[model samples]
Target: MLIFFKERLALLSVPKTGSTAYFKSLRDRADIVVSGPPDLKHAPVRRFDRFFQNIFLKMYDTELEVMAVVREPLDWLGSWYRYRSRPELLGHEKATHDLSFDAFVQGYLRTPRPAFADVGSQSEFFRTRSNGRGATHVFRYDNQQAILDFLQDRLDTEINLTRENVSPKRPMDIAPQTERRFRKIHAAEFDLYDRAR
Candidate 1:
């Protein structure tokens, strides 16, 4: 679901945050079609880059609207850690190599990797070479319905959004201290989020 969002609505799948649910709804609605490259697992980045160049931007040139959703980084990191560290999601080999959340966060900062490394970032999906820079619209994951409404207007089509693939169990709550750390860790993102408020 981490496809670029341009002509075809790319759901920059930011790991958790109900992305599975959103993708399922889009699948059922058939508002648009979805496809991935044949060598998805081995060369995912190349797949995405090629898709953007060959498909997404090409579609945009023809006047198609593109869109996606993003979650707050703290929430995104929490879900990502759980997904990567939890026993069920990984095999013994991968599980044994797990890094602590704090360590992972540090590594993420040191490396030139994509934000979240699950879903593409605001910069990745939206930015254009000509300098419009990242997207016509970005919907906060917390306010998906508003985004859907905006999409409905842009697409000139009715979309009755619904959910699917929700986890039966609740996620561990984000603690006050963790929330504060997250705000500090992603100060720029926090500032932008606040300004948008």
Candidate 2:
């Protein structure tokens, strides 16, 4: 996460939506940077509200508006599948080396998801709190230029970002039935992504 004190904005690092590169590019320009420990780096809306918001409110006398990128739900899952398919993870139980995309989705559908398919949900990540804190701005993962443009205009500087932490290239296709099931199971995710600018 990168917090721009002057702008009163917090750029949330949503997993699989490619926030790492943004974090890297904005680190120096940000007032506060949180990039260590995967759990903290990928802090979701709830976590941010509990921790960062209170601190910012006390110190800055303003709540930083949160922003995040969300990818299409299926594409997001495919990234996770491809990521886990990397050679280094071949023997690991969390790897998707031996599973088809359909199987991965099936695992996600399970009450107790198999490790490989327990990719986090984007909708839940940016879900609004009862206290009215939530992502004030959201961009689609595919809409990279728009995100960069937003950052550039907000920070008053050109933003440069190289792709970082890309999932491996693969024939990542899902079965139609699996896609339908996934969409049904995670309808809110699709809804949220559709709402993203």
Clashing pairs in 2: none
How many collisions between residues are there in candidate 2?
A: 0
Worst 10 residues of 1 by lDDT: 38-47
Error of 2 at 10 (Å): 0.4
Question: Each prediction's Cα lDDT score?
Answer: 0.48, 0.88
Segments in model 2 whose C-alpha atoms lie over 4 Å from true places = none
Query: Which predicted model would earn the best TM-score?
Result: 2
What shift in Å separates residue 140 of candidate 2 from its native position after superposition? Answer: 0.5
lDDT of 2 by residue, 1-197 (tens): 88988898999999988888998788999988888788888899999998899898888688989999999988888889999998899889899988888888899899888888888788889876688578889999999889999999998988889878878887767789888888898999999999999
